[model samples]
Target: MLQLCRDASGAPLAPQGSVVCIGAFDGVHLGHRALLARARERAAALGARTAALSFEPIPREFFARGTPVPRIDDARGKIVQLAAAGADLLLLLRFDAALAAMSPEAFVEQVLVARLGAREVWIGADFRFGHARRGDPVLLRELGARLGFGVEVFPEFLVDGERVRSSGIRAHLAAGDFDAAARLLGRPFMIGGHVVRGQQLGRKLGYPTANFRLGRRTSPVDGIFAVRVHGIGPVPHAAVASLGVRPTVNGTEPLLEAHLFDFDGDLYGRRLDVEFVAKLRDEEKFSDLDAMVRQIDLDAAQARSLLGVPEARPAGACA
Candidate 1:
């Protein structure tokens, strides 16, 4: 079982002892998994639970609220990935003004020591935390000596001579490079959200759709693509998805519109994981509704041909 905590003031998760790993873990990529695996190994050796401490809004998002800073994954997606990556408990500390005001020492004493009761702390080589980003591996070791917790910092993770990072993944997605993005993410980049009501435009055009609102200003990727819809049934359903502001409809917020291939049922309000397989084309506006519908038909055919039914599985699955 995975225990989830949102409040630092809540009951202690690991009263006995815990091996703690902390990071934004935005995509819970291969680099992040390596660190979590080490925590799992240490926890097994020490007879302790593995706990991951991460911040909501990822600090960067909170700090750059009005700016168009897209995320590799959403909160719910991050939670699922963390548990799959071997975290027994997920401590999603809410990043608010109060937490932002807390100093490094206070954060260690109150959150790590009191709430989590951490026995071992693992972090990435360049991980930074606490108010004004004053916390570091050296500081953690100093606190560990006094608090009886051990600290381990991993070196920068690299792949193909480039550091594996959320930013790198975002860049690849923006460039419509699914292969490169998959390499960095360790899996297909996906948008996970509940199906929502749409304008029925696709239905009117003979292409029924499942719409998902991202609740974010921008997306890491914005285009029409061949995709797989997961968490909808026992098997992944093939689909064609458009991620953009629906220029033809004069839509504002970026939305994910998935048109499942030869499958239908009520999906509204049901959570679905839309996994990116291949970029078909960039989102574009048509001269009219008929033209738009024609384009969609062509897109569907291309997607079906590209996906070829049995999509090759990525190294990891979206948990």
Candidate 2:
């Protein structure tokens, strides 16, 4: 389990011997993994707890007022992924204007040195912090020497002969290249949300679906995809998902509608983690209901095949 802490008075909570990694850690992608692995190794050698310090709303989102910015995952999902990466403590800092106004020295003295009691700090090569983004790895190294702490900066990580980064991943996902994005992330790109009630038009079309309203404004891709729905159990169910505003229905907000293959049960209010396996097709507005139904059938077959779900099963067995 990871503990969340908030401090603004420059008061130390943990003992003065923690190993900390500071960043946005939005996607927890391969680049983040490299930094975290180094932090874990250093923490073990120094006999200190490993902590990841991150911020909510990200600075860009906070400043942009929910403009057209791409987010790989929400804050909650990021915490869950970071916790799974072997962090002992997860610090979610509030990124309001007050906190953002702190100088580089104050940030180090108050947040890193005082509140977390950080004995060692790990960050990426391009890491920067404090008011107007004045802090840098070089500055941190100098400060660490005077503050009686150590600083380690990891080089940029590469994937597919390109520098791996959150922005690159977002670009690939936006272009509907899930496989390339997955290679950079070391896992499938996933969207999680609660199943909400829709217009039930799909049910009328003979293809009942569960609709999900994303918690974040930015989604990676807007298309139909073959996906795996988790949070149901260990075995991920095969499904076909549509992510976009329904032009045919004249809907306004972007939505995700997933039709589970060979499954029957009410999923209303149940939170689902939908992992994109492959892009089936870009979202399109069909001329008629019959055309849409035909395309959905094709999508279902492709999704099942892509997920490796057996075409035939034993009698009375779920597909």
Candidate 3:
């Protein structure tokens, strides 16, 4: 069973000692999978369980702008992906002021030695931690030697002769290169969240949508797109969606408004995973609702063609 631990002060993740890895793990991309594999391998060799220690609110999110942090994956997706990659436990520590205030020694003593009982810690070549980002792999290794555990710094990951970076993937997504983004991720870039009620503006404009909000979280792209919606029932569904603040509607927050083709029934509060297929256009404001409606009609048509699915226009669409 995989454990999801939120409080760092809780019982030690693995009392028998653990092999552990830590990172932002924003995308759990190909590179992150490699890191996790190494942790799992070391765990197996030592006959110990594995733990993945990551921060909630991601350090970037906490320190950067409040909205649209340009993230590749959300929290729940990271946890699920990490577990599937063989982590026995996930420590999603809250990144609050106290955590940010802790010195390098304190972080290792409290979280690594106390909370996780880590027999060995593994991280990438550029990993850093502690208050004011003062700790690096060198510091960790030195501390580990004196503290009785060991530290290993893995080489930077490479894909196609280039290093894989979450920022690079975000840049690809922002540029509307879904293929390039997916190449870095080892899978299509997607966001997963439970459906939340929206203003129903899409419905009034002839497209009913199931909405998800990034909510002070970061998103890499903002535009109309062709997409696939998974975790709806069983099979994935082709869809047209807009991911951004609804400018034409005078919206302010980042929201994902997905219009699943030919579907009906309540989706509110149900988990929806949206896979980006292709970008249609940038988000822009229309002078009037009628103009916005016409553009949406075109967007829906383009999406249907891109997805190779016939238009499933909801009943009562404007002529």
For all candidates, the clash counts are 0, 0, 1
In the range 1-319, model 3's lDDT, one tens digit per residue, is 7888888686777888899899999888888899889888888898888999999889877887464376787787888889888888888999988898989999998899989898999988878899989999899989999988999887878888878988888889999999998988999989888899988877888799999988655788889999999997778899999998788878888899999888878999998789999999999999999999999999999999999997555579865
- True-vs-predicted CA distance for residue 116, candidate 2, Å: 0.9
* RMSD (Å) per prediction: 6.0, 2.9, 3.0
Candidate 2 vs candidate 3, TM-score winner = 3
Off by over 4 Å in 3: 65-68, 311-319
Off by more than 4 A, model 1? 309-319
Tell me the lDDT of candidate 2. Answer: 0.85
lDDT of 2 at 175: 84
What TM-score goes with each of the models?
Answer: 0.90, 0.90, 0.92
Selected candidate, larger lDDT, 1 vs 2: 1
Instruction: Specify the poorest-scoring 10-residue window by lDDT in model 3.
Output: 64-73
Off by over 4 Å in 2: 6-11, 308-319
Give each model's whole-structure lDDT: 0.88, 0.85, 0.88
| Candidate 2 residue-wise lDDT, 215-316, digit = tens | 565787888999999977779888888999988778789999998887889999999899988898988898977888898889888888988885547589
